[model samples]
Target: MTTATPAPTPAPAAAAETGVPAARRVPVARAYRFELVKLVAQWRIRLLVLACWIVPALFVIGVEQQSTLPSDTLFGRWMHATGWAGPLVVLGFAGTWALPLLTSVVAGDVFAAEDRLGTWRHLLVAVRSPRRIFAAKALAGLTVILLLVAGLACSGAAGGLVAVGGRPLVGLDGHVLAPGDAAGKVALAWVCVLAPTLALAAIGLLGSVTLGRSPTGLLLPALVALAMQLAQLLPLPVAVRLALPGYAFTAWNGLFTSPEQYGPLLIGVAVGLAWAVTATALAYLLFLRRDFTNPAHDGPGRRAVVLGVLPLAGLLAVTAAVLSPATGATGSGIEQAKVERSVATAFAHLYRMQTRQLNRPDVSEARLRATAACDKGSIRVPVRGPGNDWHCVVSWHLPGTDATGTAVYQLDITSDGRFVADGDGPKEVNGYFLVRTPTGDAPNPLWQFDGDVELLSHSKG
Candidate 1:
């Protein structure tokens, strides 16, 4: 009996000899590797990866063959004609809910799955501390978010290039960008969304840690996303609106316009990071204090709720105060003279561009001089204030004809220097037309309309 105490396992003995504590013995690197391995083996994650690749690919193929362009979205009007437009369309749809849902599928499960499987005790025994596990799980979730974005963005860009070819990308400012520059801009725009996407990951992780159930974790984060989106459309004060995460979703769109803006993008990144840090901190602190032995007794602590609810309530209170009519209209002053002058100038320029695109003879920029008088709403309204109903009357001259006519334009101007003008011109605005190009004439009604109807915006100075 005394003769045989078989030697302890070599690995365990070696580990003990190192003098490191048991918890310190299992390297964080090992934890990370284990978490990553588990993540890739997940069926749901695999399915999501597949969908990311397939959906964008199919969308590209379908858009390429389609005759009509999806004109409602930012760059949809040019999707059929340019490769760069596909990413913009994809971004618009992704911002709605797709990105949040996709990231949540895995992030929501990372920690809650352990409790669901009754493996908390086992996991604790295997690790030094719950902190390592928490860190690993959070890292895994963020990794998934990045991978999904990268995969989807690359697939969309590839499908677009193959289907439509790398033609020049059109900007919201009515300017053209080289294919390389546009590609970079599109890529950066995709990257910009990642900040908010990561915040969604944090939300998922917070829910997972709190509820200890994957489905509950997933649903809560998705609901938060929906709430953010609805809040954006509320006529809240500019400060409140600008602070909403939903505004961050659209910040990247500035990259596609002339004189690309970084203000929105910076604010978006900051807000997104703030949300992520706050959620993650709550999750980490809760996990540190949670009881692992009796998992059933564990619950999202009151402190967790307080931490989460306080910030949200503060934001809501601010929003409520701003939404009160007592705050007056939530918009910057609409400079009537500035609006009239800018709109007239934009109309003249856009009309010239339209004619050039049509290759219509006898239309010169000089002859297209436009004089506009803008009235806010009805004549009794006195051309002041901003309530979406702004009208403009323009008198213009056309070349090769003694045609001097007035066109009535309806304008919708925002607090931002953005304006939309719809008018019936002397001729078809952009409808049925014969496109004459160096490649030869083709009967494509890409740019043809009646009464010269136009939509114009001036987003820059």
Candidate 2:
């Protein structure tokens, strides 16, 4: 037998002769490419991308034709004031519902679809490593989400610019921004939304892996976003709200203010990163430990659950430790000095606008010399903190007038440092809700103005 042994036809040669290709290991990059190809090939994903690019444009056109604006949304009242407002108003709506649902549609189904089609075993055999497969799929989902967001932003901006024309934007602080400056800030605001959206996608990935069902995965992130929205309506502490997943949606409000605030945006990014890392890690561990042989068993085993939960708890502790110092007492309480400064600044700019509308000489903010004294309830009560009972007496000097003009404003402040100031003034000045301008009847800036104090600033009033 030894003499006759035809040096056993080599395995490679035998397989080649049999017309069967050898099973070769796929590198991570190759696996990633495959995932992207699969995702792009799906009709639904193609439609989603197309819709993302087209829907916002239609929305802008629709808004342009409408008489009444969506005043309840931030930047909505300014839709006709500047082209940039159109995109911002759309952003406000997308952040609450569209973003989470859109992202979940892909991220939640990426992994679960393989399980649903009974292709997990085949995928595992080809990739040879669950870790690589998970990494590839997760990266693919994230890439798609980023693309969708970019499409929405660009389309919205383009539509607004074309339909309404570029114009000076009225900022949240009542200051006017040049067309170029407003364009840049609007783009940056859209960029800021990416963090929380990615975090939501990661959560969707976790749901997809744990539940092994596309429908559940699709709904989980949306449900979580809704829960966060509801929680925001509660009287939770400012720090807690800042840490929430939904807060990033409104954090862009600070960017439009004069002396732009970056604290909320920074905290939002950190919180999002923490959530993304935690969710991805849990999903990866669960995917790695899952028993593919048993098609009926979908849930993770006890040991896998322990391994996943421990890291989540540890990461949460670490996040809290890192955020505590940065937030400090700033979020714990709203300082009276900060509120006074914000109100005074807003009033000065708005008063200038009022003067212009009345066909008077334009009043410069510096020349206005506006000052505000605010108190919560009676003088005995401290003026600091958030409340509807706060009242402010604002005094300003017009350039040529010897007599100082004083306006009494009733304030309602929220825990997050935003406030609405309703002026109690004679009808001829600050009391009118609308003012007749050359263009049309517009909102009276001094009647009921909105402003936000900078919680992170160290400057004393």
Candidate 3:
């Protein structure tokens, strides 16, 4: 009878017994690197990066070919004045719509794609820890987003500079910024956009974790952003508007002003961080509890959704409460004094431009001593809020004369403190739509001018 020899020790046990190390588990950094490689290899991501680099250049070229300017958008009228304005105008459009949709392309699909391909089991087996996998995927998505945004900024700046040349940029407050200064501000504006865009990405990530479907995950965040944009158009309280995610899109407006307001930017950053942290935390919890064994499982049921939403709603309510006091003082209505001051300053600047066009002696804005008195509607009520019926009478001293020149202007004001003032011209001074200059006919700055006022009051009284 032959004695059965003991089976040779298993490879892992033999390695342990021999003082040799067994294979090490994959590190989080390696998982992260793998994620980056996967993202880079995908056709969709490659196409997105290409589009970011090419689209803005084509847009700049198309705008240059057209005779009419996109005057409705901020910096649109200035596109011909300086190349720097091109990037700013493009930024306005991108912030409104493109950012949410583009960011969601990666963020929304990061997890959903694994579900779609039935690779969750394989992924979990390879990574071992769900937390590390989540971190790796999240970091990869963020890296792609940063890459796209940087590509857009650099492409836009390059295209604009090539198409229009680097002239001084005209600020919203009628101040001119040198090319160097404008470049810095443009970079900062793009940086400010990152916070809100990342918040949108977090929302996409949550949808990916909860929905378990690629299409729904992709569209959810964009639809939510669109809804918020529509809500902002309603006549809501100032505090309510400030708390909305869409408000962050317009936060860069302050950076283009004379003194550079920071209130809106600060509020935007705070709101974005609150939303991002809350959504990411919720997503992490949901991901950890997901039923990966069943590939056909279609996300959470109605009960799960309600349970998940409750905490988010409660947290947002708390955020609104904290923000209300700071924004409440401005919520009452736009003050008349603010409007008067803005109009006077804007008119003084435009009048100076008109004088320069006429080849007349230079007149200082301070010496103009411009003053405006405004009233709303046929009843002649004092202007205290936004309206299209508001009218103003502006009086200023003409150059080398004691006689005061007065002009009547019809103002159409929006709730966000932007206004278009159409002057009832003397024809000779303010001119019509276009004025004759020594070089040629040009747009009359005094005929119609845009101005913005601060919604919040800083007055001690």
Candidate 4:
């Protein structure tokens, strides 16, 4: 009876001060702070931050340093609009490799670390609820992701600004852009790109729940990223890319131009969110039903695989559609359509000749092929080709002043006479002028257009 005195009636774990209402449930703020501390203290997270900043910064310097400004090099064509600095580098490299891996490193391990530390019991005991604990981890991961995104973006911009001059950016679609416009659009692209990737952070959460540890969950988002990129390359229906979270990876490039193309951007985000929400929910549900008494993930199992595969399959088609070179978008007006059929034929012989004809210096043409009209005041040369023909308008200007005038020759020619308008717009074709200058010799690559400009790059035809 004396021993059953309940050990002197031990007091409850309550507020330090009795009147403080039992400390009002430990204020979720404390838990949040605790979570932040845990995340910041993570070596994996610090390394990831380093990767985001250092790697992309180096990439920016590497490409910008090597590439010639206004370079028509393939890499230049694709990335020059954003320049070769950190922003472009991050945009080019981060989306391809760094971000995905960084995301995986932390996200995949978010929960696994707890299991590894045997802290599941401790965390559960303190948080008291699985859902709240998951929320804290998810929030922590997102905070980390955003911070990384910001870091990468800042480093890229700084690198580009410092090394390469802030020049007008060329877009993926081969359009020149203003500096301010380019910056704003690039920022928007970054936002669009990140929106879908947030799901990746959520993916880590789901992985953590399933693996009961962080490291075990990494494979899901990595596969998702790789799969999404492949999907964009496949020639499929738009629904494919639209349904995948990784679709945003390529759509970021579209933001560097006018009439921003976010078809893929929106799709990627929707699919990613769908995956993030559903998978994370399932992860928690699994936790609720699972018995973690002996927490162990089979290193690399097929279980969390569906988490990566399902959304990837759905979005692949969407990405393919988003990236499929749109014939209409590039070369498909009624005029362009008509031109597409025969524009090549008209230029074919010259293209084959592979000759680099000197620039002609004649503007306003006063002569015509006998078919000249007086009242019409026109000279339109009928350049005929196999089944297709084009009328090269010949309005005259002084011969010597021609090359220096508003007349733009929209063509890319080799050292030989072979030339192609770099695809769908007007390229000035300097021929024997009505008032030709024999001394006309500067090889100017400049070209202009009336109405809309469409060029046929040497590769296209």
- Give candidate 4's error at residue 3 in angstroms: 11
Measured against the true structure, the TM-scores of the candidates, in listed sequence, are 0.79, 0.88, 0.90, 0.63
User: Best candidate, TM-score-wise?
Assistant: 3
> Which stretches of candidate 4 lie above 4 Å from their native place?
1-25, 67-86, 213-216, 292-461
Alpha carbon lDDT at 443, candidate 4:
23
- Encode model 3's per-residue lDDT on 1-461: one tens digit a residue: 99998876458888888887866567889999999999989998999999988888779767866889887777887777688988888888888878888878989888888888899989988888899889999899989999988878888888788889888886666667889999999999988888788888888888888888748777877987888788766656667666765566777777777788678778877787777787888888888888888989767756447645676667667766777786655553466777778788878877877788779898898888999887785665655767788888889987678898888888887776677888786776554778888999887877777777666654322
Rank by lDDT, highest first.
2, 3, 1, 4
Error of 4 at 377 (Å): 40
- Give the clash count for model 3: 0
Off by over 4 Å in 2: 1-22, 301-310, 376-389, 437-442, 458-461
Q: Cα deviation in Å at residue 450, candidate 1?
A: 18
Give the candidates in order of TM-score, highest first. 3, 2, 1, 4
lDDT of 2 by residue, 1-461 (tens): 35664564347778898887766678989999999999999999999899989999889878977988776567777777678988998898889988998877889889889877889888988898888899999989888888899888988888888889899887878999999999999999998888889888988888888878547666888988898788766665556667776677878889989888898878877787778888888888788878888877665645544665566556556655656676674444577888888889999988888888777888788888999998886868877767899888899898777999899899888766778888888666678788888878877879887788765665476
For residue 245, what is the lDDT in candidate 1? Answer: 52
- How displaced is residue 365 in candidate 2, in Å? 2.1
Worst 10 residues of 1 by lDDT: 448-457
Model 1 error, position 147 (Å): 0.7
Off by over 4 Å in 1: 1-23, 312-349, 360-376, 379-423, 430-461
Q: Candidate 1 on 1-461: residue-level lDDT in tens? A: 46777765446567679764333446677888888888989888888888887788689768889887676556776777788888778887887878878867878778878877888888777876787888888887788777888778888887888899889876654456899999999988887788788777787888888777647676766787888877664544444555565556777766755556576566667767767777788778777878887868445667657765576556546644644443343443345665666555555655656566666664654577777787876667756434468777767788656877576667665433345565544335523344465567643322321111111122223
C-alpha-based local distance difference test score of model 2: 0.81
Model 2 scores a TM of: 0.88
Instruction: Give the C-alpha lDDT of model 4.
Output: 0.51
